[model samples]
Target: MKITGIETFCLRYRMPYALTYPRGEYQEREAVLVKVHTDDPNIYGWGEAAMWGGPFSTTTTVLEKQLQPLIVGQDPCCPEFLWEKIYQETYYHGRKGILLSCLSGIDIALWDILGKVAGQPLWRLLGGFARPIKAYASSGYYRRDYGLDALAADVGKAKSAGYRGYKMKVGNLGAAVHSRVLHETPLRVSFQEDIARVEAARQALGPNLDLMCDATTSLDAKTAMAYADEFERIGVRWFEEPTQPENISGCAELARRTRIPIAGFETETNKFNFAALMDAGAIQVVQPDVIQVGGITEARKIAAYAQMRHLTFSSKNYSTAVSLAACINLLYALPNADFFECDADPSPWREEFLKSPLFTFDDGIVQPFDRPGLGLDIDEVALSQWVVQP
Candidate 1:
């Protein structure tokens, strides 16, 4: 069926607790949801672009004023054609950042439509290699009044929730340091302090459960290598984004020096960038966010490329329920997918924004929705409540 109309919504909500990383702090979360209506009766598709720490308004503008117009009358079934059309048309003015992010939402929605038309789940439609993919609790950001004790408690709770593994944040100045001070100085934590937090989490989790840490690209290669040795001692699974995304050489060096696998590239926007990372032998695990990397179409390409290179493919998906659903579908089809990142922290939007449960976790394993398309029924009433009017 032909595309009829496209609508975009900007949702914003105050986070239950402020979270701090190496970059800064976030007190609120945001997402941009897209709905594509088709000519066929009773057939529409939904998708979301993560705006977690970015400007939702800018992404919304790109969706409405730029990308939306390009795809309104095209065939929703041909997501690849439309994806390329949007990318090539906007190549001069927009190839990355919010532009690609906007394209991502639309592309995912189109895939959802295609799945509905085919009467199949997205994963099955793609490959259907595996189901009930393993997941890890992605938590442990520095929060107000939160210390090592609090971190230990958080890990314990995730274990009790039946997660197989948990990921914690490192490289922040620590709970004692104010975010304002961090913004000004951006000081890296001492090696000793970083080790202490990981050790506390390990102790709380015990030796069996998997443990991972994300530095948010705050540590240099030298520091990351040193920390890697300590993390290995504590049985940490992997180190994520220890150095900036631009420092491909540094990441390569870090990977070479340490036995711990280096995972990153969430900030990358295209396959060419991923190829560069692979060519450099920089990252062992490639963490591509579907929305950030240009939707399912591009993500599939990246996953295939990672597989060809014999690299592990795990995605970075700690946003809204829509993004989580998209990621699960993509990962289920990928043979080499290691883990699906789940936010251990609570989010009202993830639970309350949808009429039906998008996914369920059974002892840290999540199964794909059997229903056609993305298998999500958006709660329009709940969505209206959180809509940011322009």
Candidate 2:
């Protein structure tokens, strides 16, 4: 069947709690959702993408105005071709960032529609790899936001909630305090540490905690190596984003210097970008976000690629339960599935937006469902209520 129309929704929701990162704090979250309609009876598909680079680069606006128009009358099953067309056409103006994020959502939604039309799940259509990916509790705390004791308590909260693995903020705190604070949590606690604090955290946490660090594209190749030397002592499981995402060469060099595996690609737009990161020998673990990285279509492909390379593949999650449900369905389809990220912040609305929420445990595991499509029904009314009119 051919495409009929595409509609866009800008959603804004005030968070019950704030989400703080080293970069900034978010009290409210904003994103755009796409609904693609087809000529076949009552079939439709849904997708979500980032609406960033406002004014200068209207990602969703361009997608709704230009890209969506181009694909309106085209075949819904032509995701690859349509994606390539959008890429080539928008290459001069939109190769990376917001443009790609918009394309990602639409492309993902199209795949979901294709799966529904075929009477199959998105994972099955994408070559069902595995099911029930092990998940980690992504503790919602930052150095600036919570005191060391409070951060430790949050980590404890995640452990008590049945999360087996957990990740916490780093960079802003001293390595010694970061390590001491993590000791309060019971499970594997990975920190968002910079290269400067690597040695100190290693010394403090010692060998037991599954202590890892994230550089967040903040360090150069040479500087990253200094921390790389301490990996042996710290027994680091992974070193994440030591250099900018585009600096694959630097990532490669850093990986080569340390025995620890380098993890990255959360901000990646497509499988091609992931392939580039892998080719550079810059990554040992591929982290693709369900919403930001083109949904399940591209996520499964990227995971498959990581599997081919015999590398670890982990998916990132920071959205609501609806988005998490979508992620869980795809994670069920991964072969070399690693830990999944569960948004640990206390948000009742996040729960209110979903029909069947994820089953998270103190052991840090989330099981996949036998249900159809994403396994969880979307709350259309709730979606409408949160819609941001523009």
Candidate 3:
């Protein structure tokens, strides 16, 4: 069926308690979701553009002004053609960031449409490698009053919830400079406190489960190397984004020097950049957000590349439920799918986005969804309050 129109919604979920990473303090979660309408009244697909990189209006504006114009009459079934068409037209001005993220929403919607039309689930539609994909609980953002005791409690919760692993933050050391962007007035957690947090988590998790740390790109190569030494000593499974994503050599150095697997560049938008990171031996685990990296179409390319290189491929989780489902769908069909990020945060976004949970968890592993499309049946009521007019 031909595309008829597109609807955009900017959603903002205010957090009860604010959380801090290495770069910024976030008080709310924001996303731009798009609904693609087709010629038939019966068919439509949902998509989302994450708002962590830029303003929410920027993404929605691009959807309404730029992408919708070209996509209005095109067939949503041909996601591949539309993806390239949009990329080629916008590459001059929109190679990465908000532009590609907008494209990603539409691309995901197009795939959802294709899956519905074909009467197959997205994972099966893409490749259908295997059903169950491994998952790691992703949370532990720094917050006021959340000490090692609170950290241990969260770890225990994840373990009790049947998660195989849990990932926590690590930029508390003095002037934790994680990303290359260089934010002013960064927060600090001393080395002693940081180690205490990991040790607490390990104690709570016991010996069987996994524990990964995200440096939030807080440290440089030298600092991260020293920090990683301590992490390895604590039996930490992986060290994620220890330094700035753009520092290819620094990342390469960490991978070369450290025994812990270096995972990163979730902020990254393209596969070629991923190739550069891979080529440099920078990361042992490749992490790209499906929403940020041009949707499933581009994500698959990265996964394939990671597989070829014999590295772990895991989608950076922490977006809307639609993004979470999209990542799972893509990962289930990939050979090197290592850790699917099961957002362990207590946000109302994921479960409320859809009418019901799309996938099931078996002891922290995500079971494949066999329903048509991305298995996203949008719950408009649940989304209504978060909708932003501006």
Top model by lDDT, which number? 3
Clashes of 2: 8
Query: Local error of candidate 1 at 81, Å?
Result: 0.4
Off by over 4 Å in 1: 173-182, 185-189
Cα shift from native, residue 261, model 2 (Å): 1.6
Model 3: lowest-lDDT 10 consecutive positions: 178-187
Per-residue lDDT tens digits for candidate 3, residues 117-203, read 999999888888875776788888888877788889989998999888999988756556633454443456677777888889999
Tens-place lDDT per residue, model 1, 1-390, is 789888888877787778777777677777788898988868998888756456777778888888878887788999999999999999998787777788889989998999999999988888988656778899888677877898999899899988999998887754322345555433346668878989999999989998999988777777778889898788888899888888889899988888888898788888888889988989989887898889999999989999999998999887787888889889998888889898877577777878888787898898876889888877889878878964
| lDDT (Cα, 0-100) at 80 in candidate 1 | 96
What TM-score does each of the candidates earn?
0.95, 0.82, 0.96
RMSD of each candidate relative to the true structure: 2.5, 6.1, 1.7
**What's model 1's overall lDDT?**
0.84
Quote model 1's TM-score. 0.95
Best by TM-score: 3
